[model samples]
Target: AVFLTAFMPDCDGPRTRVIEEVPVSDWMDSVVDEEHAPPSVFLGPEFVRRKLYQLTSEEDYTLCQSLARVSSYYVADQQQRPPFSAARYGAVTKVYVIAKQDLAMVEEYQRQMIAGIPVAEVREMADADHMAMLSAPEELAGHLADIANNYT
Candidate 1:
């Protein structure tokens, strides 16, 4: 099984639909400045700090900033594309690993997504935030390994 850690699956819904549903406050900066190239999504450092990660150290915040990118419209368009039927992907063993402490994609929404699309298994890490890869790497890795042992 391909264990998804703090991942929102495609089958849950379209980006447009999900965005509409989620209470995402002023998260995007559509403005194009000299420093920020045209047609880019800008998520400021403060937002990233408060909304994206459970930073245990200063380095985690720095990592968040360094990893930030101008989310491409093409990718957004692709995400906006119609969702695949559950039947199409039902054959594959999907596992959802929920990050309980995530502020960006909160536990309720994660549960809703999981409920939207039935998965083979669901694992959870109570300490992890949206950036579980950084916040709770060992636990995430352990879950992946466990899932792999069962599926692969």
Candidate 2:
């Protein structure tokens, strides 16, 4: 299971919510540009069709149909409580794979949500952006394996 604690894409939430207090167009541009690269590389026509089919197959198309609808509601939702508070698992270990560069902001938000999580390990990679998992998958995977070994 993954607990994502960050600004939500506008497409998933309601409007009139402003998380970063930034202009709507700027945030939209950033999110789209960030995801566009990988899709261009990996998401060919077939992949696009499959993804569209999957979305249409889902019953929640009312929500899905409003694709790219920007909203800051997710931030308010996250701010109200911790990301993992509603998780199904109890007493299960969790690894927070955060970007090294985002440590400051992520930690600040985490502190507001919960304290004393006993970070089992922290892997800091150099020159990695917010999307470190995509930017440095091998390095991230290696770190994850190392963490898993420690538990075993």
Per lDDT, the best of the predicted structures is: 1
Query: Evaluated with TM-score, which candidate comes out highest?
Result: 1
Q: Which stretches of candidate 1 lie over 4 Å from their true place?
A: 1-16, 26-39, 73-76
Provide the RMSD of all predictions against the true structure, rounded to 1 decimal: 3.9, 12.9
Query: Against the hidden true structure, what lDDT does model 2 obtain?
Result: 0.39
My TM-score estimates for the predictions, one after another, are: 0.76, 0.38
Instruction: Give the per-residue lDDT digits (tens) of candidate 2, residues 40-122.
Output: 11222232223222323233333444453433334434444433432333345555554444432344543332233433444
Pairs with backbone N, CA or C atoms under 3 Å apart (clashes), candidate 2: 10-69, 10-70
lDDT of 2 at 112: 34
Which residue segments of model 2 deviate by more than 4 Å? 1-26, 30-90, 102-118
Candidate 1: minimum summed lDDT over ten consecutive residues — where?
29-38
Q: Score candidate 1 by lDDT.
A: 0.67
